[model samples]
Target chain A: MLSAYNITKNYQTNGRVVPVLKEVSVNISEGEFVSIVGRSGSGKTTLLNVLSTLVRPDSGELKYRDDNLALFPEKRLNRLRQSDFAVIFQFHHLLPYLSVLENTLLPFMSSLRPVSKQRVQQARAGLERVGLADKADRLPGNLSGGEQQRVAIARALVKSSRVLFADEPTGSLDKETGKQIMGLLMELHQEGLTVVMVTHEPGYASLAERTIAIEDGTIVH
Target chain B: MNLFTIPLRNIRRRPSKTLLLLLVFSLGVMSIVALYQVSLVVGYSLEKKLTTFGANIVISPATEKLSVSYGGFHLGDMVFDVQELPEGKTSQAIRSIKLQDRIAAVAPKLVSMTKIGDTSIALVGVHWPEERGIKSYWAAANGRFPEKPDEILVGSQAASKLGMQVGDVVSIYGKNFSVSGILFKTGSDDDSVILVELGVLQTLLNRPDATSFIEVAALCAGCPIEDIVDQISMKLPNTEVKALQNVINQRMASVHFVQKLALSVSLVILVTAAAMIGLSMLSAVNERKKDIGILRSLGYGKSQVFMIFCLEAGFIGALAGFIGYVGGFGASFKALEYLALSEGAVPVFAVAHLLLASAVFALITIVAAVYPAWKGASVDPTTALVAL
Candidate 1:
């Protein structure tokens, strides 16, 4: 569950102002499947960054469960990132030096909360769900682009995070792998996992329960 | 990030590099400490040799004194001040026989040097046992310096061991001498040494005008060292004071040159070791860039990253210091084993050196780590996120 009202983001580039988000806002309730779509330089990624709490919008009353994310301290934001949500970039962004299992297990380092047996069981189940149980011991370099994305998906589900924000989850994958990934995300959405995915493929974007189009910082609802 | 687990995990990932760092520094430390110990041992040994030479007013043409000199301008490192003669110089002081003009005082020593073949003994020569022995004298056991050349003396223990009488003509080193006064017992080489007159010993050793060495008592009132030697050489004229002074100065220069060379070489080695530490840490910082990013993204603070690299460098320094100190201590023990003064002695932890090295290591490690630690810590989370 998330809400933002009249959000605006600005950047000072070599003495010139560029607005990334201009008084645009949206909301998604629990178990909602929402897609944000845009062309290059259309502020799609910036919108996702703000929604996932990775970056705060310059002027926005961003409320998650009635709490302002901009006012949350860095430590609290880190905890929020650790357990409340997960993100999937087009690139897997897994640590190159760590094995896939270690990459999947990283969120626990920021969480002081005890990692019980159930957490390990959930991680294994996620790995099994993504068909990456055999590849758990490998590093990201050892996997293909498609397989790496699968590992990122597994990592997202390992923490049992309620909301998933994906910026082009299938952008770097082939058509068959992209379709398979979209099928998995839909299954998770049916299982009451909220997902907000950004994609270039209209076919995939149309599958979402709702879609918001953004162009040069304005939302065309 | 879990602080302990992360840094330690990185070490296992690159084993050879870690060992390379360890070995390079350990070698430096060992060489430095070992040579340092050698210098301390050599200094202590020289001091022991000086004490044992056992002569007061030890004059040896100034040039000969330079044969083994350590600290500043040397004259047997005057351990004790010379005993000034009593006031009102009279006939009692005017008793000497050779080079009478330059010689201010003359005393006699007749000592029995027992021959290896027979019970008979030959005599060695000496001077006023009182004057030389008065300042900080060697204890005499039995026989004393003879009152006359004809009167030979023996230590009391030697007298009993030789089974000879006062009037007997004892054969000593192929010369016969009458055993005169027996000495009171004192423990030292004095038991074996014999004392005699400058004249008799000159005759026995077949040198008519010279004593074994002239012990110049610089008692000439208001005279510095070179002045006294100059005045004595002027009296003799056979040995030029200028030539002798030149020789002594040359000898002193050579000793200083050798010590200077040793110091320069050690300093170069220390600098090289410090440089190696810097280079290794810098290279390691580059190699671990990806790992650093992972840690930073995982919520490791900038200070935490800085500390990890600093600890790595500091650990190397501490390890090297430990290696060097142990190496130095081992060397010192081996050298001490050769000494009769100390038997198989070993050094305990010198707290002063330990503390000094700790501070030095801390300084070097921090200096060495600063650039590398800063490089590791200044990683942009954006760029680092891309690395991940």
Candidate 2:
């Protein structure tokens, strides 16, 4: 389970302070699929970033299993990021130089030791689940937009992290490919994966078990 | 996949950038290596040539007493009655010393005054073969050196004063000698003396196997002239073996100057090379900002990112060092040939030197990349969200 109490975030632009998240709070239970919906500049993405530990909130107490993650040291935060959390960005930021399988195994590549054969097999299995088994050797640049996004998904699930944070995972995909990606997420959620996704699409928000709407940096019912 | 794989892949994917960096760094290393090697060889060559300009050590009978004088008041010359050294025994003793290998030449001389047509002139006897070794710059102004005991060489001053020619037969101490050569004007005492075979002069003077002193030209390249003199003195305890300190100092000074000049230039080149590497790494960091951000978001530690760039720089430096050393060695030979000093110079292939240069360049490049690598590590993980 994850909890946020009175979270507030601000961004500085052109020497002016702008409130992005204004003392908003939300909670999600384990194995639950939650979606945050808002218009552009409504602080939906900012809330997702703050919750995922990508960006620290200016004022908040973010707790996971009775531990305040906001107070964790950088090294400890990195450890949790590697083992307990996985993020899927909208752009599918795969390293252009690496192949699809290498991108899927990107999480383990940063380690000092060589990636184990068993871990490599797990990455391959992840790629297969994303329907990219035959395209493992192809670079990200050589793949279609949808296929690239699928590689991103494969990379995320390769670690088998406890929590999945999808930030507009289908923002750049075609409707049909978005449907397929959403269907994949639905399947994974049914298998008891905790999912916190941010999207502006009402249809996708409707597919989630719970939704939190934001307007002008404040949560509105 | 290991930590190094990312950098390796990036370098391979970016061939032009890598090659450009390689070329710049290789050129810098090549210049340094070439200068270093040339300085070593040139220093050796200069020392050898300078040592041969004249003898650096002189051995003479220690019993010779000095005349006493007070200012301009004349005092009679004092004599110890021992006029000369036993040439054969003394030469053998010098050759048997511990540092004899450093001895390039040993020319024995016996000086005596003799009348030539009522004008008394200084006559000097010398071992021609040994004298020629130390007097490598000596050339025939008119004819060749004396090859026979009956032949003699007349100095320019002696020839001008006596009006002698190369083929003229001159009588010295009532013995006939053919003038084999009119010697070049050396601007030394040699220009004012008549030189004859030591044996012939010894027989004529009725002092068999006698020499006034021995002039020794030692190869002073990396050799201690004082040590050679001391060793010779130990062998010939009754003789005074003195090293010409001024000549050794001047020779060493010239060698050191050349080496210092080369080292200074090498240092400048090293610094410029390091700066160039630092700038290139900075540019690489800028280009790989997205990669750094993504790696950070994937849970790569800041130090890990720093090490990736450092490893990339070290790889470039190591390759450049190797290429530069080989190129520089070949260039050194060419430089030596250009300076016309290739002959009589020994070529050395030091493996340890090569490895040290490579390791040093690698370390230098790694140090140069420190700032850029730190910048790469400081890239925020949130950049992954916005940079795309």
Candidate 3:
């Protein structure tokens, strides 16, 4: 479980301060599928970043299992990201030089734990779960947009992280492909995996167990 | 699936960039090796040529002159009794010098005047073997050098004055000697003298085991000639040691000038190569900003990212060093040929030097990549992934 309280973040550009997140607050329960909905420039992604420890809030307290993540050292934060959390981007930011299987195994490669045959097998199974088992040896450049997104999903799930954060996971896909990706997320949520996703589509937001709305860097509903 | 695989994959993905870096690094290493080899060969050849210029140090018995005058009438200066260096002790004294290895040749001469058919000519007795080392440029014009005690060599002018030819018999102080060889005109005192075996001339002059002076040829490059003279003087107090400073200074200056020029050129090449590698790596880091952010988000630490870049540069540097060593040796051979020098005692392919060059190149490349690696590691993951 993760919780954020009165989180504020600002951006400085050309001697001006722009408030992206203004005292925003939210709580995510274990095994719950939560979707954050907002229009452009609504600070939805900023909120996700702050909660995930990717960006430090100017003023707020973030807690994970009653531990102050905001006060955690960089090394501990990296360890937490490797072992307990994984992130998926809308563009499927897989390394272009690596094959699909190698991309999926990247998390395990960076983790403190030594890689083994069992972890490799699990990564293959994760690829199969995302319907990318047949494309494991192909490079990301060779895969379709939807297939690349699926590879990203397999990579996030390969480490068996306790929490998954996806930022517009299907934003770059076609309608049918987007639906397939949403369906995959729905199935994973049903299997008791916690997921926090940010999206602008009402249809995708409706699939989550809970939906939170934000306007002007503050939670409205 | 390992940490090292990432750098390998990245290098393979960008072949042109890697190749460019390798070429630059190898060029630097090649220049260093080639210049080093050429400098050694040039110094060696210069020393050999200078040795042929004759002895740079002269040793002779210390003598004192006394002026004698008869009441208002000026008389010529008279040489009084003075210490003479023992012939047998000259070689032993030369060998006792600190830098004895630098002593190239020691020619001891016994000079005396003798009559040959009512004509007085200077007879110079010499150790032929040692004299040959000092006068390496001397060549016989008519016949070969003397081998027996009764054979002798006549200078060109002396031979003409005495109407002597090769194989002509000449009597000096009632001793019959054959003219075995006639030396070419040297335009020096050598043209007016006759050369003979030391023992034969010593017995003819009735002054056994006596020598007038010793000519010493010592290699002075990278060493002090004065130090050798002092050491010789210390060992032979009864003798005077004089150094030919002009010859030594000229030869040493040329050798040092060549070495310094080569070193300066090598340093410039090395610096330029390092800069090229650094700029290339920095550009690479700039282009991979997003990839670095993604790696960080996937749980890679800053130090891990830094190490990845360093390892990539190290790999390229190692490959370049190997190719550069071979290229450098070929270039050195060509340079020696251009200088018209035959290879000396210096080995052509020294494994230790090669390994040292490789290791130094690798270190330079790694050092050059440090700034770029730090920049890559310092990239903010959130900002880099924000557009996604």
Candidate maximizing lDDT: 2
In model 3, how large is the Cα lDDT of residue B280?
84
Candidate 2: Cα lDDT at B17: 81
**What tier of docking accuracy does candidate 3 attain?**
acceptable
Task: Provide the lDDT at B336 for model 1.
Answer: 55
- The CA lDDT of each predicted structure is 0.64, 0.87, 0.85
Give the candidates in order of lDDT, highest first. 2, 3, 1
Sequence-dependent TM-score of model 3: 0.77
Q: Write model 1 residue lDDT over B1-388, tens digit each, in one string.
A: 3333344456556678777776777677666665555544443333333323232233322222223366764445333332222111211232231233433333333333446346554445665454344224443343444566666666566677777556667655466677666666656544554445545666775555443333333221112336545554554433322323433344334434444565676677777887888787788777777666555444455666777777667766876777666765676566556553332223456868865765676578668778888988887544455454
Better model by TM-score: candidate 2 vs candidate 3: 2
B91, model 3: CA deviation in Å? 8.7
Report model 1's TM-score to 2 decimal places. Answer: 0.56
Q: Please tell me which model should have the higher lDDT, number 1 or number 3.
A: 3
Query: Which has the greatest DockQ?
Result: 2
Name the lDDT value of residue A128 in candidate 1: 87
- Native-vs-model 1 lDDT? 0.64
DockQ of 3: 0.39
